[model samples]
Target: MGFRKGISILTISAAFALALSGCTSDKPAPSASTAPTASSSPSDSGEGGTDAKLEALGLDSNLKFKETRKITVEVYDRGNDGGTKPEDNFYTTYIKEGMLRDHNVEVTFVPVPRWTETEVINNYLAANQAPDVSLTYSYPTIQTYANMGGILDLAPILAENKELFPDMFEYLTETNIYWDQDPATGTLWALEGRLNVLNRINTFVRQDWLQKLNIEPPTNLQEFESMLRAFKDNASTLLGADADKMIPFSTSFDVGWRADHLTTSFMPNDLTDKDIYVNGFDDRLFLMPNYKEGIRTLNKWYNEGLVWKDFPLYPAGDTTEDNLMKLGHVGAFMHNWDYPYRNGDDSIHASLQRLVGPDAAYVAVESFPNDAGVYKKFLSGPIDRKVFFPATNKEPIASLLYVNWISKFENRVFLQFGEEGVTHEKLPDGSLKTIATTGEKIMNSPANIDYTITSNGINLGDPDLTVKSIANGYAGVDSKLIEIAHKITTNDGRIGKNANVGQIKAEDGQGQALKEKRDTILNKAVVAAVDKFDEIYDSGMKDYLNSGGQAIIDERKAAWEKTYGTETMLK
Candidate 1:
C-alpha cells in the first residue's frame, strides 16, 4: 500500500524500521498536534455533531471523505443469553449512525464466533474476506499473515495521523500502542489493545461450607489441602441427602487454565526475564520450573478423592463444572478473579444462594504459595487483544477513525452503559451501576468489550473510579465481596517479563496445535496415578517439545540473545 499524504518516503521507511524492531520503549511517537481529551458524557439523545466537536480538540477535520466510504469491523458473536444479534443490536445501530454522521463512513460489523475466533479469522484471511478491522488474542496469527503479505503495516498510517486518534492513543498510551513493533524489519502488523484490568486468578472456597464446618479459610498449601480433605470426608454433613454429588475441588479439561493459581504459585521466584520470555509461549507456565510438582500435587489429590475425577471428560465450553458449582457441590475452585460474582443474579454465587441458602457463597482466599511462602500471580502485560487491518481493507483511515471514535470517553461510556436507565443506572456516587436489561439493550459481553475494540476492562475516566466501579458491576452480589475478591486477585501479582525481541517466526502457525498438545500433556499428567505422575508428565512433555514446542523455545532464546547479546534481562 502507498503512504498517506503528509507522510514522506523517509518517514515511511523509518516507520517501517520501527515497526520491525522489538518494543524498546513505552512512549508514543511524537505527533504534530496535541492529543485531545474526551468531552463530558454525550447527551441522552446522542445527537451531538461528534466529528465537529472532536475536531475542535485539534484532531484532523479532514476525516470526511469526498464520498461515503464503506468498511467492515469484526465483532465477537458470543450467542449471549439476551438473544441480541451482535452485528445488529442497539449498540451496533448507535455505532453505525454515529460513524456515518461523523465521518461519512458506512460501518458494518462482521461477527466471528467468540469460541472459534482464531480459526474463523484465519479462514477469513485465507479467503480474502477478512474485515477491514479485526481483532484476536493470537498475535502469532497476525505475524503469520504479515509474513505472507496479507496484513497491512499500520506504522506509517499511525505515525502520520497521530493527531486524528488522540483519544485512542491516550487510552492505549505509548506502551500498548507500540508494544508489538518488530525489532528486525520494523513492521507493525497489529496494535495491542490496552488491558485496563490486570486482575488475574484466585482460589475460591465455599465460605458457607467453611462456616458450617467451623473451619477457617486456608492460609497455605497444607491448610488448603486439609480443607479439601475435610470437605470430602464430611460430604454427607455438607450435602445432606445429596452427599454423593459433592465435589471437594473441581476443575475442567483445560486444567492449566483452571488450576493456574496453584501451578503459578509453584513457579520459582527468581526466573530471569529471558527465562520468562523464552518459555512463556505455553501461556500457562506449564514449562516453568517446579510446575510439575504443582500438577503432581493435584494428581495426588485426584488419587485421594479430594479433587474432581471427571474433569477430563469436559471440554472448553462444557457447563458440567459450572453446573456443579451452581448446585453447591463444588467446595473450591481456582478461576478468574471474579469468577463467583459474574453474571449478576444468574451468577454461580447467586444460584448457590437460591439452592442452598442466603449465606452459601464462594469467597476468595489466598492459599497456594511459592517456595518463598508468597502468593505470586504471573499477570499479563498491559496489552490485551491485538487489533489489525487486512490488506483488502478499502478504507484504512476510515477504520482508524472508527476506532478513534469509540475510544473517546463519551462514546465508549454510552456504548458500555447503554442509555443509563435502560441498561445501567447512574448511582448517587457518580459511578455507573450496570442493571439487567431485555431485548435489544442487553450487553452481550462484559462492559461491551466486544464492541469497544481498542480498550478492555473498565475505563471510567479515572483509575480509582474505574477500580471502584468494577465492584458495582455485579448486580445482586454484595459489592464488598467483589471488592475483596478484586484485592486478593491483584495482590502479589507480577506482570510477566517480555523482551519483545520481535516475532518468533517459529511460533507462526504453531500456537493452536501446540495448545492442544499442551492440554493433552497436562490432562494426562494430572490424572495419572500418584506413583506414575512423573513418568506420564515427562513423556507428554517430551512429545510436546518434539511437536514445535522446542522450535518456539529455540527461536525465542535466539531472538532474545540477538536483541540484547547475552544480557539475560532487559532493564
Candidate 2:
C-alpha cells in the first residue's frame, strides 16, 4: 500500500493487474514479438537526438548522464507469487543485463498491482510518485489525468522527436492521432498503443449447432433470424437437455455491444449520410434514429425468445458469457473482441472441444448488414492503450529517450521476446519458438513488459508478416482459426467508423455517468415489451437528458462544431 515500493514484496492479484479495463485485444499475442532488424523505417532525429549514437541512450545533449541514472517505471509483476521481483523478471533483467550495462542506468520497475490498476495508478499519480511512464488500458483515465494536468503533454516531445519513433509516429499520423486529445489543449497528452488495427468484431455463430439443426449461416437479418429460430427449435437435440435454458443471443451489462453491431448499419459517420451523428466524447448516441431501431430489433428478438432472457442483468466483462458459453447453451455472440478462433490453444476452438467434443465448430460468418444494407461496426483503431508520462517524473529527458530507445529495433525485441535462446528460440524460418506454453510466460515472461513497455504493435513494419507470425504463435490450435480473422479483415469487411473526431471536456466526469445511464436505459428498453419500449425509453431518455445528457450533448455539439465545420457537425 505504501508508495515507496522499492523492491517491496507486495501480494497482488493476477499478472493482469496493470491491464487496461477500457479497450481489450486478443489476450496479448502468443509470444509474437518485434524484430530488431530495421526492415521498417528507422528514425535518426528527435527523441534525445537525431544521431544514431544518441539513439543508444536516447539522451539529448541537454541530458547529462551520470554514473547511473535510476529511471523508475510502473512494471507489471503478474504477482504469481513465484518469488520473481519486478526488477529481476526476465524482461527487467534484459534491461539491466543487456541494455543498461554500458549506459550505467538503473531501471527500477515499481510493481503495479494488476487487479486495481486504476486505483493504484491514480494513487501514484496523486502522490507524485507515479512511474516515469505507465501503460494503461483505460483511455478515460488517461484523458482525466491529462485534463487534470497530472501528466505531461506528449505533443511537444512527439513533434520535436518525430524521427525517434518513425514507425510508431507514421502509424499515429496515418491513424488520425489515436484519439488521445487533451481536454485543455485539444491535443494529444499521452502516447497511444494500438491493440488492433484491422479486423472488425466477427459475428460468431454456433456452426455445430447450425449443422445439427441443418440451418445455413445467416447472411443478412432475415437469415440471421432464421438461424436463431432454428437454434430455438432444435435446442434439445443440438444443445442437449439444456435446450430450454439455451440463450440464442446475449450481451453484457456494462458494455452491451451485441446490439451495437445492428446499430452500425443505421449509424452514419458524416454529413453525407442520412443518419445524424454528434461525433464527440464517445459519440453521444442519444438522438440517433438507427440506435432506436437497433434496440427495437433486439426487442423483437427478445419477445420471440431469440435473445437471452437475462441479458439486461448479465454483468459485464465476460462474467455471464464465460459461464454461459461453457454450458454450450449460447448459440451466437456478435461483439466477441478476439474471436476465439484467432486465439491460440485456449480459444473458442479448444473451449468447444471441452464442452461438446473436438468436433464442435463455430461458424465464422460475415457480419450481417442492417436493413439499410450496411454492416455497422465500432471503431477500435487509432489506439487502445494510453502510454502516459507523469509530471513528477524527474528524468523527463531520460524517460523520453528511453521511449525512443525502446522503439529502436534491438531494444524493442528485448522488451518483447526477451533473449532469443533463454526465453524463446529462434526458428530456422526466422520466427520465434516460445518455450513457455502459457500465454503469460511465452513472450515477456516473469514481467508484464509487452503490456507495460510500449504502445507499438507486434510487427513493426510489415503487417502481412505480422499476421503470419500471429497465426504461427497459435500453432497449438488450428492455424485456420486465426487466419479467418485476417481473411475477414481483407474481405467484405463491414467496418463502420463512429466519428472518433474530438473530445468534449464535459464528457469526462459526468459524461461517463450519463453514457452508462443511457446504456442501462437502452438495455432495459431493448428487453422491454413491444408496447412498453417507447414508454420506458422515452421516460428514461427524458431523465437522462435532463440530468446530464443534454449538457453533454450541448458541450459536445459546440466542440464538434468548433472542430469540424458547422455543416459537418449539423448534417
Question: In TM-score terms, which candidate is top?
Answer: 1
Error of 1 at 65 (Å): 2.6
Candidate 1 positional error at 299, Å: 1.2
Please list all clashing residue pairs in model 2, or write none if there are none: 15-78, 17-114, 17-115, 18-114, 20-137, 44-50, 45-50
lDDT of 1 by residue, 1-571 (tens): 1112233334334433433441221234333122112321212221234443333222334556557778999999876654589999899999999998888889989999987898899999989899988999998888888878778777655665465567787778766677787655556778888778898788899998999899999989899999999999999999999999889998888889889988888888878888888888877887788888889988988998988889999765566788899999999999988888876666798888999988998999999888888888889988888999887775666788888888888998888778877778877777788886767787888889899887788888887667767877888888878988988887888875547677787898887788888888888988888888889899988998898889889998898888789787778
Backbone Cα, N, C clashes tallied per candidate: 12, 7
lDDT, model 1, position 20: 44
lDDT for model 2 comes to 0.56
> Where is model 2 more than 4 Å wrong at Cα?
1-64, 71-89, 92-99, 102-105, 108-129, 136-143, 155-188, 268-277, 283-287, 312-320, 411-436, 443-453, 489-503, 563-571
